[model samples]
Target: MKLREALALAIGGDLAHLAEVARQLSSLGVRVEPGGDVVWGPTRLLGKGNNGVVVFCRSRHGDIYACKIRRGDAQRPHLLDEARYLQIANGVGVGPRLYAYTRDVLVMEYVEGTPVADWWRAAGAEERARFVADLLRQARALDLAGISHGELSRPGKHVLVARGGRAVILDFESARPGAQNVTQAANLLRALGLTPPLEALRRYAERRDDLAFNELLSSLLGQLKR
Candidate 1:
């Protein structure tokens, strides 16, 4: 389906309202990418959630982005808030790069990778170790930035393990202040069958300094080696 049609379906309104929406999108310099047909229902989409749906888009410059659009029934204009949190995460190197956003739309980097679940199972020991370490750094970054991902303990499909073993944490829609990112990530590590480095993690949580972080990394890496 066409981008306008798909967006109209996701966010139904009067004809005039829809036309205005199209104008806003056009002014933002984005449109559906050719040959990109990822879909869930009638709409060509990258992903969908309760608040919004994501579609693949191309800038006039032809760079691909994941455009998040607010669903019709969603609480209005949450993408702006999501974009802000994502920008904070981007500053700390924890989430996808946010490019631009309006009340109903968000444009951000498109991550091509496997969910951590599938990726972990296929990754070799060293790869798994590297993935864990990357996630730890990202988690620590969020912790230090004081933004909790809000669902990291039940990470679900939130962490994307891309090529070269970088683990990109996704969906800052639920991110909030007063983070416990490292603690939640340790819980995730436990769920993934690694022993949590409790004492080291606690020390890192208390200090959040380089020495504490290095000790925690060493502890986690030793578990992977065993």
Candidate 2:
């Protein structure tokens, strides 16, 4: 089925609202990539979550993007609101680069990467140290930006580790005003059995400065180095 055919099922809106969704896509000059994989969730979707259904779409200039369409029953069914939060995350170089957004749809950079857990398991000690350091750096960035990821404590599927070992955090639906990202990310580090005490990493959050975080990072790196 094509995007429109799939939309009626994905978005539980009435006929007019559905028509508007189609209109919006066309007016914005997006070319939907009809063919999709059936993995990651039900149907031929790229992925699905509480707030939206993600699909691949290309621009007129041939730039591919991930499109998130809001669900009718979504608790926070405002794609634009999510876009705003995502933009804040992007301000600090955190989330996928947001391109354009309407109330029902958000177009963003398509990250071609493997999930962090899958990548982390196969990486060596050096690679693991590199990833841990970068993740902590990003968590520190998010903390300074004041955007709490809300779900990083168990971020198994929330992080994508791409080629060249760059780790990109995904899914900002649970983000809010207060940020505890460093603390939460430390939770992930603990889960990975990275040998850092949460209490120590927790201090980095309190410092809110590069010197303190880097000192902690140096300590972690010292242990990671063999």
Candidate 3:
């Protein structure tokens, strides 16, 4: 089935779920216009994940926003978690600003940028290393703040290389509190097929020096074998 058709079916058939979402949106001061076939003009589908669907929409105020709509009743908690995480992540330079959210719908500042994986594929090794280092810095900040993005390892989850060299992390549905910074960094590296640069990251965390960071990363990569 077509993607739009599938979304319509899910929204229409699930009245209770829709009502809950509407209630949440209302509480957040977002106006939900009533109509049959509510279509935002020419919405581009970015991608879909196990937790929710993401679509780019031009808001009534002429601002572009990434609208993430969750799929089922079971997914509601994840949406709520994302809302909570965004509250902490606002202005952190790690993720998008949470503009609005309901039980099933989330509106966020749309980050126009290439995914880190794609950027890394086209980038030279030095640029990729820099990107990795910058990501680690952002992760450390979140860790210091006691926030854990539960799905940080997913490829496409971290949107980078935005306008003006800004990187923004997206998709926080599974994010929680109280996760180890080192473990999260390890998992992200493993997912990217890079040896977990634990030692380098540790050095950077300790002394905030790039050269020491690279040496530590080399040592950590060596340790990953055994």
Candidate 4:
């Protein structure tokens, strides 16, 4: 289907509103087929979630992108907010790169990989450890940057293990600036069934022992590397 038509169908209601949206999209250099056929550039539905529906779309240059579109009734702040957070993540070498976005649509580098749970099941011990390290690194980056990923506690569909052993974190609508954060590390420990670190961190906090905490984290990383 034409891009505009597919968008219209996905977000139904008034034709005029859809036209305006199409116009805005066109201004952003987006091209849509008028023909009701989606064959020119194939699209695959990536997912449909509370944030929006994600589809893998190919550009004329044959580059694939993950396009996230806002549902008609999706609440305030829109895709723009999500786009902003994604930009932040991009700066720190986390998440997919943001290609472009308007008020209701987001286009970004398409990350192809297996979901975390599936990957975990198939990964060897070394691979699992490395993946865990990467996950913690990313979480630490976010926390240090003052960005809180509210859903990391229940990660769910948010993390992907890309080809070549890369870990990509997706979805940022629930992210917000915060003073201190523990969602990422806590959730990761929960997944790994490691509870001692949480308590160790608490003890370090009480004693204000930065070196001890660093040593502890280093010890954990070393074990994972081995």
Which of the numbered candidates is closest to the native, going by highest TM-score? Answer: 2
TM-score of each predicted structure versus truth: 0.86, 0.89, 0.69, 0.78
Model 1 misplaced regions, further than 4 Å:
1-3, 12-20, 34-39, 200-212
RMSD of each: 2.5, 2.2, 6.3, 4.9
Over 7-82, each residue of candidate 4 has an lDDT whose tens digit, in order, gives: 5665544765467555645555554423221232333356666646676655666666777767665665467878
- What's the true lDDT of residue 217 in model 1? 79
lDDT of 2 by residue, 101-168 (tens): 88888888898877777787888888888888888888888888888888887745688787878878
Tens-digit per-residue lDDT, 1-226, candidate 3: 5544445444443666666655655565444322222343333355466666566555556566677767564535547777888778775667888877766778887677887667656765555566666666677667666787776676656555675445567777667786454456656666666776556656655664547545755554454344
Best by lDDT: 1
Compute the lDDT of residue 1 as modeled in candidate 4: 55
lDDT of each: 0.78, 0.77, 0.62, 0.65
What residue pairs clash in candidate 1, if any at all?
none
Model 3, position 103: C-alpha lDDT score: 61
The number of clashing residue pairs in each candidate reads 0, 0, 2, 2
- Candidate 3: list runs displaced more than 4 Å: 1-6, 10-13, 19-44, 158-160, 190-194, 197-226
Q: Would you give me the overall lDDT of model 1?
A: 0.78
The collision pairs in model 2 are none
